[model samples]
Target: MNRAFHRILIANRGEIAVRLIRAARELGLETIAVHADVDRAALHVLEADRAVSIGPAPAAESYLSIPAVLEAARASGAEAIHPGYGFLSENADFAQGVIDAGLVWIGPPPEAMRLLGDKLGAKALATKLGIPTVPGDDSERDRVDRSAEPKDQEKADAALIRKAKGVGFPLLLKAVAGGGGKGMRRVDRESELPEAIRSARREGHAAFGDSRLLVERFVSPAHHVEIQLFADAHGHVVHLGERECSIQRRHQKIVEESPSPTIDPAVREMMADAAVTLARAAGYRSAGTCEFLLDEQGRFYFLEVNTRLQVEHPVTEMVTGMDLARMQMVEATGKDLSRGQSVVEWRGHAIECRLYAEDPERGFLPSSGPVLMFKAPEGPGVRVDSGIMAGWHVGIHYDPILAKIIVHDHTRERAVARMQRALAETVVLGLTTNLGFLQVVVRHPEFVAGRTPIDFLDRHLRDWKAHESPPGAEVLALAAMAEWERLGMIGSGSGPSVVANGGSGADGDGSSPWRQLGPFRLGERRR
Candidate 1:
């Protein structure tokens, strides 16, 4: 066992680093934080016992630089490294390098990372293990550039047409190694296939640096469900139930909930079983996630496996009452997980929404600026896992995520209500954020009732956007403090005022930050 390891280095930044620190502290281990120039003042760095400056602000010069991180770990005397969900978290070479540096790698072995980090490899391995997978394109089709079809082009044209017909129309072009909806396209007609393939290849190259693309059948309204599993080097594996992440935009999940409203007990058990089978086949050790797609008929198909921690690990911790990060560290140290699949008990409903600094109205584009003020929500059932606080600068160098607001309750209905209220109380005024949009989603009748499909937002999102309302007395009151700095007070507080603090400004006419710019303020307050 790694009982001798006294200190660990958290090799990432933001909320995930904070998350790892919390877990490490609880396990009676000191932690180290590595930060880039921009993240030097980040919360994770402040919370860790030791902090090290790795490199410049750009990710390539900082977080993605392996030798720099290892050097920091070695210099800090950290016995092991915990890669929390991004950057080198899934980098197989980095994991092996950590091992080669004589530092404990608090994650799956490098071999297992190879099996799961690559989309094509993971799917092929899953299928060989008899795990039913979605019909994803796993092959790189060498395009016979028709431009190179030669002067005898008529025969080549016939051959091209034959290949197109064989592959069928309405195909999905995807990167052989891609995630987060990158390098993906839905082609609804044959005429769009070649162009779609080219665009997908271009994007794949830009994102993963490899342009290999494949085509698969498009599946609509598919639910994105994943099983969180844990294993030790002893070969004991356990599934920690499934998380419903269907409420997404642009193919990325913004809101995720445990005990999926769509899955029944039988389906949950079956899905969990399938995940365990896949993990066993991989000989995976440590915490990992098995992603899948549920069709209209409720058939589950393996998508790919995330061999490291997930951004939404907190939600699973809420339902399963297990500290996933701590378990990962322990398992990496050769300690067996206490709760096996048979003993893993899920309690209550847990829901999480990612808080991103973005303009939802503008395709969720990333927003960056100084967070002059930042206020996160807090309530009986609400938990906010955030990276930045007031006075922290927000940068576009990394993901736009600000925090993850999660709520836990005994029932799904309560959980929805809790999330709605939590979003309402969340205020981030100085920068644009998805807070207002998140509130609308949380309160939508379809979402509250859990009658949502994959494309629920694609259709109903407009309904929420079209209908703009003036902030009520409460919203004005909450936003009044920040507005007080801009516009003068409305009137005396003897009785009632226009907006909160009697702030003198346009009322329901849409001049308020709450209405005009949406709920995305750089550092708006919510009490």
Candidate 2:
């Protein structure tokens, strides 16, 4: 049954929420932005046709509260709900709640989300479908038996160790409900298994409220690549090529590019076919991503599936010329795909760099403060999707990502050069950012040669530091003039007098008074 909706409610915040609003407007649909009290004046809220407050600043009481989100949708008279990504996006119960409330859910069906959202379940499905998966124990009985008595605890631990040994060392302990690198740990040997299991369980319980864990053999010197899939209720599914997301830190991707440099036409076809097969078997619809690990032998293993929109989706869109958000909405209405697999075309290479408000020098600690100045690079193939402005205050309550910079060009070399230029022109003056670090990564020789592995950062730039270039002579002169104006010496006769001995005023130290002004960059504070 097809249900048409005139208005849609975005059930997330930040850059993705803003992105949905634009997509909705383009389709002649009214948008309602929901926010926590702290985000009353956020860019998304200001951009939507209507805004509603769900709760306080805490996500639990606001965005994650299904009842509160549903109430906001009802109160705003929204006919459909779009969980952009994260938060309640992959929650199957939330999707059912939306459908139960007589409103459209612009995502996969609840059943499909449940089948593919769980790491264990997805792995089992892949094996059943003859898809290659990393060697590991996907057995639910192997999970830590928390409810067992003290005497049984030792038995449970021993059983888990036996399973780990069978799976082999250098394995990853992952949470069944984990995403974005949360609730995961790596154990290289048998001696570390018990403690690693306990640690992974605690982290998983805290992050996803599920302490269940799964073990998989870790693949080394591998490239993290994912296929973008789109399906409709009419049995149509197509892949939008692959994105190489091997350059990462802490298991979270920071750089992504489409048409992986390592994937030949044959490997690309195999991966695409496997992804489409999984989506079809699971009865998935709407926009989703199927992640994989590609090894040096040209073999690929299926990772978990992200049953929602991805942050790096823009790169796929840039290469395929498709509007994923719009496609999701169209599929939600029971429309068949406008095009088939053979007709889908991919062109020019594209790359995206995620900019975060974190200090790379200080171990990538998150930094929060008011954005003093924000200038995004602009050119023929540059694109920036951002959530904050000059006056916006970044808080510690949410993800530190400020924006994503994407660029496209005819060739990979040209695309790399364009990305470097765009990164250089990007400016965020108020807080410490990874702008310089991103520039360094794109310019590395190995990266240019398309040889990025999972440990690219640790293997290459482990001891990376920010290089501070001294201000130029013109900048010093301007700073001196500004300092003199501030001291009221410009118009007064007591102004600093220049001497032939490289001294100014009464000081013979060869330094100006402005030298006392501690670290500051010359730039106008944008409002």
Instruction: Tell me the tens digit of each residue's lDDT in model 1 across 1-527.
Output: 54458799999999999888988999899999999988887889988999999999988888989989999998999999999886788888999999999999999989988778777777777778787875644444343332222344444334433454566665566666567777887777877766666666677665565566555656677788899988997779998888888888777789998988998788788888888987888789998998888888888887878888888888999998888888888887786556656788899999999999988877888998866445566669888888877557788899889999999999999899888878876767457788888888889888988867777888789544423443444554566554544554434332222222222343334665644445433333432
Model 2: residues >4 Å from true position, as ranges? 141-158, 469-527
Residue 429, candidate 1: Cα error in Å is 1.1
lDDT of 2 by residue, 421-476 (tens): 89876766456677778988999999999888999999999899755554554665
Alpha-carbon TM-score of each model against the true structure? 0.85, 0.88
Which segments of model 1 are wrong by more than 4 Å? Answer: 1-3, 141-169, 462-527
Any idea how many clashes model 1 has?
Answer: 15
Q: Model 1, residue 195: displacement in angstroms?
A: 4.2
lDDT (C-alpha, whole model) for all candidates: 0.77, 0.84
Q: List the residue pairs that clash in candidate 2.
A: none
